[model samples]
Target: MDRPHSTSAPRVRRSRAEQKRETRDALTVAALVAFTRDGYHGASLEGIANEAGFSKGAVYSNFGGKAELFLAVMDYNLGALRGADWDPLAMPEASGSGAPEPSAGHDEDPARMVRGFGLAMLEFIATAARDDTLIHSLRARVQVLIDAYGRVAAAGRPDDEELPVDEVAQLMAALEQGATMLALSGAASIDSALLRTGLRRLVTPAAAANEPSPVRDAHASPLPDVERVRRLIRDTIDS
Candidate 1:
């Protein structure tokens, strides 16, 4: 009689750092989804931990507090959207009035950049509309944007005598937030049109003059509309 040998292979083990990163990423994704749905005030660390399949201590260890967690979520979401492939500097040139001359050594086309910005805004609004936690998190992000933009405008090129970057950022954030609120409240008509118009106006004052109305013409072909906008956003974020 002959004996058979076992054929099973040894399993590979993950390094501690790799395991930690995996756990951290899972927590961030869970938090993003949970916060978007529950809102910052409503979401609990325990709930996030449960969702992530981690313990409460894990959540606390990774993020000091709810605010830090919320900020991390924002960074996660925004970082997903930024990169050289979608470089702000490569956008289409603006052909309208009040367009800021491209800063020296900065050659991105303003028109395309504005369109991309509009798309990014619409995506954020859409996400917020679907998730209460995201909405709350975004409000905090808006405040940060205002403060950061204010400081930049005050310090860099103060003599430009333009609409303060902080003011523009706040206005954009408000419009996007308000539009999302309206959409969520059954106002489907309140889409990215307002944001597109505002951004265009902000980026190219001359273009604003050419078109008395910022809204794309009512009779104009829809151009695949909302889904197209969403796709662009997904591409930006996922890129």
Candidate 2:
């Protein structure tokens, strides 16, 4: 019993760099929430710092200013989406591989989070359009996504196929941005499943796209039965 002595673990300390990184991350999360609530024009560094449980100086020290902070938030959110854990971009695993199966949201009400961030992002993009420097930064960040998409497109196509990466990326980006905005704006008909199908078809090889879809359902068709309509028209004409 005399040999039994309780010892406490030594206190571990974070280096200045580690502490700084932690502060930046906390600030980013708080800024994400604040930006979503107030947007880029309405939000303030002071409010974000307070939300993050830090002084306004922390935001200034970690980020140049609001523009920088917003970019950081964009990177964090968009990067997470691009990661292997999620496929928000509707990127196919292979060129013609079947559409990725839909999965449940990772968190409670994930759609809310998506809409919130999407709103803030679109607002900032609109605002940035008027600012050259800010737009440049935004373009650079967006280019990263486009580049990744180009790589994927190139991968899916045969080496002989003339897949203009830039063109392909531009089309995919346009579709993705437009589709996301529609979905976030409460388009009941626009969901991930449809988005996946649209994106999958967009990059599918010309030869494969002409072939009847291997999977068919109510969602697959976007219009009335044209063949049936044509047959009825012919019958009516004959009659």
Candidate 3:
């Protein structure tokens, strides 16, 4: 009877919920790196799983499919973008006369903020340019911008005021994609100089004034399909 003492210790109950959450986090991180490197079409669930040290079935179980995974990647990247290092000019306080000085904890500088945004955007575009899956995701983002601008125009804003939103969004997207491609191809420096210059020019009062107005009537010409065409061309070329 003494020799029959139980050999096994009591088992701790595993938290299935916690395990699932950790799995989802791993898959999302892996998808981000893979999509950034491989493009949306080029990246696969299997690849993401491998990157995350999980099985492909794990990815499928957690994310459903490529589209859902892509959305996850987008959310992850945007989150990072929003957390970028500070810039003073873009900070609300910087635009005001009574703005407080940069405290030891606060890094407020608008130019720096714009530059940070430019750099993050460039890095994202460069990564997407190399991956098929990511390209599709980027195309989706472009469509979103177009749709957003269309809505702004439809909301009865003055034609002149509304037009620049779409135009500026298009220009920013193009510059970002183009610059990323060029930088990746080793054709230009990846710094924000060119982007900053372009942004300044695009936002100039004269340039804004000169932009084509959104149509004012119900029968107004459809928003030019230029952004769609541009995205298609860029995707095709990158592919």
Candidate 4:
């Protein structure tokens, strides 16, 4: 005889909870890739499940549906970009934290930037807009982000009726959404510089905080008119 045959090591059985957790994690990761690649409407539970090596039933068991799944994806990737670039407190330079700077290499591939996490985000926003229930589900999470944004807005600004931090935060939030939509669409060329400038200006505001305050002195300057003409001219050029 050559040698005695030895059995392989015993397989360690995982608990049901462990299996479920693992299953959910795997499914979520797969869903992330699917949503990123196909977007909200384009991604399917079956496809995500297949990608994760689970059956479609696995997704149903773990999540309410695709909307919930995407929300989980957002939660999973909160920093989303994973760079130290995010500071919900992306405050004014006065605080020392300073406003976020544009990524070092965003110009590399505009399409990739949009179609990556940005497209998935836009897709979910569109889906959420049509459904009150979905928007409601999103509001809590949005509130948390807005709260941090509000803090950034509130730092040096007053919370009074003049330059309500609430409105500033909300407006900044809207600008962010609108810009992401336009940037992702590729219908018109939009760039990070425009987004950066919008944030900077909005954070700083047209009216100096000390002079006439933010909301009050908006009309005290001719710059707004100049900007309007410039924007119109740019639009005409693009058209």
Leading candidate by lDDT: 2
Ranking by lDDT: 2, 4, 1, 3
Candidate 2 per-residue C-alpha lDDT over 39-149 given as tens digits, one digit per residue, 9 for 90 to 100: 777889999999999999999999999989999998986565555443333422332356343344322234445556667787888978999889999999999778766
Each prediction's TM-score versus the true structure:
0.51, 0.73, 0.46, 0.61
Question: lDDT tens string, model 1, 63-130?
Answer: 88775676676666554533223221122233359745434333222223333333444555566668
The lowest-lDDT stretch of 10 consecutive residues in candidate 2 is: 220-229
Clashes of each: 12, 0, 19, 0
lDDT of 3 by residue, 114-223 (tens): 33333444556676778887688787765654444334333433435434566755664565556555644556543343344444344443553464542333321111
- Rank all candidate structures by their TM-score, best first, as comma-separated numbers: 2, 4, 1, 3
- The local distance difference test score of model 1 is 0.55
Q: Once model 2 is optimally superposed onto the true structure by TM-score, how far is the C-alpha of residue 85 displaced, in angstroms?
A: 6.2
Compose the digit string of candidate 4's lDDT tens values, residues 1-239: 69987799888999999999999989988987887678778888999999999898999999999889888887765444222344332321221366343243432222342357576776687879899889987887677556656766666463343767887788867776666565456454334434445655566654333332123322111111122223333446559
Give candidate 3's whole-model lDDT: 0.54
Model 4 C-alpha lDDT versus the unseen true structure: 0.62
lDDT of each: 0.55, 0.67, 0.54, 0.62
TM-score of 3: 0.46
Q: In model 1, which regions exceed 4 Å deviation?
A: 1-13, 81-189, 212-239
